[model samples]
Target chain A: MEFLNQNSLYIVLIITVICWFGIFGYLLSLDKKIKKLEEKINKE
Target chain B: MVFKIILGIGLTLVIIAGIALPMVSNPSSFFELPVVPGLEDKARIIFFHVPTAWVCVIAFITSLIYGIQYLRTKEILYDIKSVTAAGLGFLFCILATVTGAIWSKFTWGAFWNWDPRQTSIFVLLLIYGAYFALRSSIEVEEKRASLSAVYSIIAGLTVPFFIFIIPRIVSSLHPDPIINPQGKIHMNPTMLVIFLSSLTGFTAVYYWMFNLRVRFSKLLYQQQMKEQE
Candidate 1:
């Protein structure tokens, strides 16, 4: 707990990076899903 | 596919650099000007907070344009686009509000201030939320599309008033950074670079999210059409 308080800035930096990377990851996965959907729809 | 991948990689890099640069850079006391007095280093929140609010307004404007297009053409696709844009707009609006609330809690020593800017943004959130509720409550597809498009148009028109005009018209603790006549940013050069980079990075993120949502909806529509066949 004391470690968290003293290093709040680094903690924030880590959290921010994680959150942003998570968003990008979600978008990347969604892009893949859309590609597959497009392929499926095109086949019909 | 390649374009989007490249864009994704580029945007991720820019956003990471934006966030990292601000955190790592030294705070300057040049000209005895501080971005936000009393907040000091914590004023770095400005990079994230301001850009999210800007993106929110951009999303609302995009929604408004699509709403108008839907009304003009009465095309279902236009309506779909409008609703999708509104959905993203509302999410970013809520983001802005939440980030602002957190900043306020730390800076002002309270979470909810009822300041003019705070009140206006809260109202904007409620308005956007109501737009979603209104859409979900309607059962008929055509009616939902048409009515919600009209509602979105009206609500979207009011966003500028809520976000920009009203807050400035009344006193508020939130800094009126853009409205300065000179249009000059007052900050250390490094801070300015990070601020501008964050703004660009956020805009990129907004478009990327918007495109993802729109394409996902298009896929769903395709699925729906096949089901009706």
Candidate 2:
């Protein structure tokens, strides 16, 4: 487990965090944009 | 629904096994390493890197199919589908690049070596980036769809060459020269089960994403049309 604590572990954690948030953020933004469009359509 | 549930279970099991593989002792360990203890044994990256590339392959295949459909039927839905798939494909490409970069940093001393495989992926990114730029530049919907579809078909052909062919020809610092020239495998039965499980799980996730993106694009397109009317 000691080897896991080296600099690479930090690097991997950073990569994983970036991957997690980046993907979810895009998905959420796309959903939000679609919802706004739908709301506008309903108003019209 | 059952299939999705099964895939979820499979992904869970695979992830557990992947996490356990390095920790397991004796014959359970796939191959012993001389490196420092518990070096994060790279098999975990299979959960990430391979899955991203698989999703990208799936996305481009989808783009090409819809590209042809748009050309044949001239249906706006198909055009929307093609562009949406390409857009998602580009995102997957970026994901794959980042994952690969991180993996390289650990295995290789540096992250961005100008190796043949790396160079080709960079080129692939350029090709897809240009595709989106081409779409955004054109104001006319039909014209944008037609040009982007054609470009997508041409660009889709580059994927196999970059992902498969170039990697084979070049001497990589990667792994498994004798067994895995065709994208390293040869995991023991236990590891193989875990790897396959992850692949199935990711395929489900990919479809889920594709469905959502295509639906969003269709909705947006319809809304735009209504506004015009």
Per residue, candidate 2 scores C-alpha lDDT tens digits across A1-44 of: 66776655456555545654565557557656767877876787
What DockQ results do all the predictions give, each relative to the true complex? 0.54, 0.19
Over A1-44, each residue of candidate 1 has an lDDT whose tens digit, in order, gives: 99999777667777877777788788888878888988888888
Which residues of candidate 1, in runs, are more than 4 Å off? A1-3, B1-36, B180-185
Instruction: Please report, as a residue range, the 10-residue window in candidate 2 chain B with the lowest summed lDDT.
Output: B31-40
- In model 1, the Cα lDDT at residue B71 comes to 88
lDDT of 2 by residue, B1-229 (tens): 4654565556555555554434333443454322222334764676567777878878888898898888888898998888878878888889888878887887776789976767878998898899988988999888988888888888888888887788768876555423574545444556556666676777676776777777777776777787899
Query: What TM-score applies to chain A of candidate 2?
Result: 0.67
Q: What's model 2's lDDT at B62?
A: 86
lDDT of 1 by residue, B84-117 (tens): 7888888888888899898888878898889898
